[model samples]
Target: MNICWWITILLLLHSCTPGDGMDHGIVGGHVSVPHSRPYMVYIRDSIQPNLNCDGFLVREDFVMTAAHCKNLRNPKVYLGVSDTTFLPLGIEVDSFPHPDFNNEPGNDIMLLKLKTPATLNKTVTIIDLPNLWNDKISKNCLVMGWGSTKYEDYSPSKVLRESNVTLKDLTNCIEPDVICNEDPFGPSQGDSGGPLICGDIAQGIVSFRKTQSKGNVTGYTRISQNLLWINVVMKQHKP
Candidate 1:
């Protein structure tokens, strides 16, 4: 589908979801990745349990997530995540929301500048972005997130969960403007901004999944498509 179509779809999706609530904490995974690396994000609200999404560390104090995950008009972010634990090595976000994001087709992407830098270790590794045109990720990729298992009106769980899915070929999974034409397999609510990892390299940000049975496609904002924006945001916030 074309860009305009995607944008139109995005606006509709945004309108369907009610965004008038306070922050709430998530139910997270019982076990962390073997020495879990940096790729977990927590979305916060003022008066509710925070939701969990996934993100990656690009710089010491910066993270990237999908724009639609949290609307800019009402936005908050938390980084340095593992099983819902916000480490002392993490940061509370100062600002987020992507510049070019229209939130349609989930082009919605954002970068978070930490109030302080994270303390890193071997487990906290950064994932490098793929080229915008890399097109290397095929039908066999892995997705990890701290989201829900089922879709319906529900709150994020107490422990995080994850699942793997194959990237559907565009021709086979053809939807329109959105990421997957087929049904999304893994990840659910609270996973809107997580990574669509192909091997160890970061390629896309989990954005949207069609509300259907066994949807193969999970929408993601192409990270390579937003490298410039990431750089600009990070530079502006340089200490």
Candidate 2:
């Protein structure tokens, strides 16, 4: 689709569902390649016991995720594991979305702070935020999460999965706040809040994806605009 079409579709909504048009999620067909991505996180909201979303570590104590996925009642952050049900180190803490966040007007990004800084090891690491502000970074990117492996199947994946997407130039986005990615297997339901990575730097947070078409129209919250906010929040909440 054209750049204008992508920007036009981003309207206000009840919540940021993270993918276009659906009940099930992340339509990609593959397993996560081993410990290839250890920064992936499983977020469980107390408000919705069954709803689990994904996020990533941008700092030792901060996890970046989609704002719409915000849940406040002793939320859980699970890291250092491939399987959600496995014995990975987990933490329960409060989550904070961007102060400018609203589901519809979409700033769909948030920072999660741990009560104690996560113990980083080989299995648990941090994905650096794109330290540069260049509008034209690499279009090639990788998004990993524990979302559905098929459409209309709300079943969260046993392990994390990575979907290949291209951060094409869609310069017309509103406020230039969101980035649209081209992917056949769009960021599914549970995939919300996951990071869109360019090499080791995190470029985007999986927002919403459009469905019922040839492919999903995936969108992410451009991290560049929120870099200052991220830094301020991290300082205020440093463990």
Candidate 3:
């Protein structure tokens, strides 16, 4: 598997500039940890650790993310965590990459099962999947991730930035060679496989950058179509 180095550079050189109308420096629009928590994963021998990304728990022990984030060479997960300081508190764990994960560019979502169930406390929590989020999410939705707020030729700032984006029609998304690209560009390099959430519903995962555009769209594997797959995965570890 050939790894792209730009992915590494973009993640490492994250720009930390706070701008107007941003999530107050949240790299992916997440503010100081939500009642419904989101988390990040760090890879070894790649870039910095404890960096942010969007994730929610399915079971107490299972945290799902994109397949590309599972570079075990330096894999680490921060549950309900925000700052780099919280990285140490993150319990290093095991990961399960999707069997058919397309590492090339787009279809790269993955699931991560922590070695031990996260110790649920007041601080750590999970977001439930909304029933209608997938069916109704067509043109308007919100995407959050730890990607670069602006294409400033560097890595995303440590803060989790977020923005509301419109979904592009699939007809346009599946052009001659294009797979996806809707709005708000996409999540920055390290923001892969994060959630494209709308309210309580998870619409899709942050896929990849559209060539040299702003960010990648949520080239999400639609939850509605993947319910059977999700159910099978969840059944493996009923909690």
lDDT by residue for model 3 (138-188), tens: 566665555555554434545455666666674455322122544545466
| lDDT by candidate, in order shown | 0.56, 0.70, 0.51
lDDT of 2: 0.70
Q: Is candidate 1 or 2 superior in TM-score?
A: 2
Query: Best lDDT goes to which candidate?
Result: 2
Task: State how far residue 153 of model 3 sits from its true place (Å).
Answer: 1.8
Instruction: Give residue 4's error in model 1 in angstroms.
Output: 13
Task: Rank candidates by TM-score, best first.
Answer: 2, 1, 3
Write model 2 residue lDDT over 1-239, tens digit each, in one string.
35555554432121334333232224564667667788887787655446566888878888888887764355678878676657454687667889887554357888888877888888889887876566556777787777765545455566777767776675645447788655676566677888888766788888876553555567788898787888888888866
Question: Model 1 — which ten-residue stretch has the worst lDDT?
Answer: 8-17
TM-score to true structure, per model = 0.72, 0.83, 0.69
For model 3, give the 10-residue run with minimal summed lDDT.
Answer: 12-21
